[model samples]
Target: MQKILCFTALFASLVLTFLNTQSEAAIGANEIIRFSWRANTEPVTGYKLYYAEGAVTGPPFNGKNALQGNSPINVGNVTQTSLSGLDVHQNYSFALTAFNECSESAFTDVIIVYSVTISIHGNGTVGTYTSFWTENHGNETIHFFPSDGHFVSNVVVNGTSFGSTESITLNDVTEKKVIDVYFSPEKTVERDTSFPLWSGSFNENADVQGSIFIASDGVYVSQTTDTYTTNISKVSDGFCPKSGWNANYHLIQFIDVDNDGWLDIAGFGYNGLVVAYGIDGTNYHTAVNVISGNFGYNNGWRIDHHIREISDIDGDGVNDVWGFGYNGLVVAYGIDGTNYHKPKLALNSFGYNDGWEITDYRRFLDVDNDGYLDISGWKDGVNYVSLFNSANETYDNIVEWW
Candidate 1:
């Protein structure tokens, strides 16, 4: 059952003076925001919902304000529509435009909406979310467990550290709360006669779309780790299906585009495409090529070094992705509004060009508590490290081993 929050009377009329129109309120939730408008005298096909982060004043629709989150609520001549995939506590300005058979009407006056629903985000192998009980504005408890081969690294709420507690009771949920629990995969590596414990903090960054991408022998996409055994598919079904996705799905990354409470999954496969699966909080979803084999000439960009949730490089509220390629090309994967893992060149030490002396491991630290991921790596036989200055976007070699 969907929780309705937009209208106080189940149909609060929004007074729109354009040709004298009124609309019902919007439903705000962890994953969706519903909006409704009264029917018009003229015949129309559907309504288009446009939203942006802040308030916008326009004569021609966004005269000075930049808008985002594009959707044409196509419910077939219905007055009601819900905009899904939204984050908690974010302010969104929405505007409605009617579309007929051929053309779209000018944007109507904007409506301001806020997401008061609490969101719980869990990362790592087969992530899942379960709301104990909807109190709307009271104490809430969040619990998590690592998979068979994984362990919980840390739990955070609204950017505050919540430590290693598997379950946490949020004291007051007056505002929309975002709880992110990160997990790291652990494996025992044989050092010689014995196997010592080796654990890493990977997949620590956050998402609200709650999507998990699993790439072991094959790629699996699921909303929770629990149904992974059941929801796993090879053809991608509705998500992006590639010719060889059934084969070399090596690395998987979870990202939340559009700031929605759910996370989307990015797959680094041997087929040379960074395919991403955007979960719609349900089974229906699609995976697209973030980078295809035709992209970057298929550089054979195998990911090295277990990626940790390094400190947020910028103050954008999301952790920046730092990836080291097999070719010594350091790349950063960013998400578009649609949640695609688009890689940007962060740095290139050209380790692959230098006799293919591979750089195996890398780590990130602020050192001085700055908002940048300082680079540290073990290449060839060198234990060198670099410092990141976010202001200049350059890495100063603090230590270089020859």
Candidate 2:
């Protein structure tokens, strides 16, 4: 009985060795590869996966010849499957062989995976400014389309588009007016992400054009044709030099500074000069020194800059100038028939810093036919204009009047 048992064990060992060799030889050049695979019959428990750049057969698939790495990856003792990190974009050849205590199986079919791309363009008017929006998907149909007007009406979701009825007409028509376009997505996505996705504004003659992205603040304005393209972030600080000027001597305001009924130009540039030029019905006269020695940076102790807000502040039927300077000071100067007043700083017992960073100021005509002169300023960080009651010398945060 002992002799019989030894012979049977020896025979089983020889069969196992043969099966192992046969399994290694079964893998072919092309095979559908997975990081892992299921064990078939034969008590199989694991897999050995191999890959190469081009089609090559046989073993020792290592060194630079291997697209992955130098070592032959052994996927040890996995019950049902395995995992691999391979480039999905490239065309790769792979093979999977099953493994167990006694034998292994051949590789499966070769399968491929690839990627896709998409493009977008704007249709309708090219340079003509309109609020309309249209996005073309790969298909001939329009995927994202919204009509022109208020930005609140245009909505978009995970690439899907919806339209709303809310809209605003272009009011306060001027030489240059900015029309802001906003995108208000649904609640499921995100609130802060809703922003001004598009913009269009008018030029000096009301010619329309597409606008670039500002600071995501949803505020945009047009530049006079003569003005240089300025970064949107600096627009509120006042008119920066459009062209042909120095840094300290920037053009502050373009108005009828001389009250000649026609619009004249007045600017406070470097060297404390509030220069004025007459629009002689056609061309500008050589700038006359109006308030040359009275404005701008003083000897580092303090710099009293020109008022960015320029309008008729006093209601004396003449346009007055108003500006803010360093150290929380607001200056107001009247344009007399000949010259401007030495700018008077608005005074408070506690002094000028009442959270007002004045950008531009204007006298509000009693549009409702009220008798008092109303004053207002374009302020910093707030969308609504700041209106002041000049008669009572009080400030009110009013939105409807603006």
Candidate 3:
């Protein structure tokens, strides 16, 4: 079977610098923000910019002060313009509409940004600033990360449950305040196929604006008219990856193991940290230091590089996760649902190591139609396949595609 596997840690430096550029809020002054965008269709006289403080619930805003007040600021005639007299530290919504003598187009989707500053406690760090920063913190969402060898427990502010997620816009914290965050030792006993398979947002469009997929070196989300897409904020570990599977560690895989409807994000650096974001469906996620200290190339055995997935190999109720890396090497975490059973190097090569090689490509499929999932990929310009041996929970047999 063909394979599709695509997937950090400059940590936080530039952001911290920007956040530290100005501590005191630029309170009560007009800030100039230049705006530029594509031009409208023909027959258009000009474009109109409509803005309102906070969310734009609806029209019929107080037109009396619409022209001047920080709320409902309207301007016309120019393709682009500079917004001034903006209220500092306040969330603002803006929409654009084209106008001619005949009529005006419907206002585009409203884009909003609120002011915010995030801080972290304990030995872990979160976001760029600690507090009192002039950031347009709209929907303030920050993940809490703990130190090594730990699982985030007894977390506060970010919400309930370990590494809960909360929306700052909805939380409505008008004043600056200190949020206390904590972590705890984890009792995760790595078992074969025990850890739930990583699942994206359940209930569709609930956790994401659109469907999520990976390509090349980036994880991407596509918007469809069938449903909206999830808005992606900056994932931890920095921008995109710079190298091979090394950066894959920063790839955030989403899983809802408890089936609580909330998606938890997992980030791995192998030698570094394996972080899980948002344990519960609390609309929030924390940095959650791979504190659990399990299933990593650093803390323990090394594996799970470019790809990983959870599944039941045999009829057994237990779950198993497999990771495919370079050189046709495969690592398996054998957990019988709740406890670790057999854990070791699952596969070295599909038996053609001398000439063929597995290069960042693999997918589990029952190619032989034996009702059991098999690992398949292209090697030496041909297809190489394997089947899961229920007795030992390993992939066996090597066949080359004609």
Q: State each model's CA lDDT, in order.
A: 0.43, 0.35, 0.43
Per-residue accuracy of model 3 over 1-402 as CA lDDT, tens digit each: 433221101111111111222222332344444555556544455666666666554553322223244433445654566555554445555666666666666666555444443333435445323232223433434555556754333334444233323222224344434444543333222211212222334332453322333333333322221321232212232212432334323444565422344454454445433433433332334344432343455533333334545445544455454455433434434343323443345677642233432244567778778777787887546777777776786778666645
TM-score of 2: 0.30
Candidate 1 vs candidate 2: the TM-score winner is 1
RMSD of each: 18.6, 25.2, 21.2
Model 2 lDDT tens row, 134-161: 1111122222232242123222222322
- Please report, as a residue range, the 10-residue window in candidate 3 with the lowest summed lDDT: 8-17
Q: Provide TM-scores for the models.
A: 0.37, 0.30, 0.35
Model 3 gets an lDDT of 0.43
Give per-residue CA lDDT, model 1, range 191-280, as digits (tens): 111111112221344331122333333333332333333322332432123333332224444444334444444455554335343333
Q: List the pairs of residues colliding in candidate 2.
A: 31-109, 32-109, 32-110, 36-82, 249-269, 249-270, 256-264, 307-323, 309-360, 309-361
What would the TM-score be for candidate 1 when compared with the true structure? 0.37
Ranking by TM-score: 1, 3, 2
Off by over 4 Å in 2: 1-245, 279-281, 292-294, 299-307, 327-329, 335-337, 349-355, 358-370, 374-402
Q: Number of clashes in every candidate structure?
A: 13, 10, 33
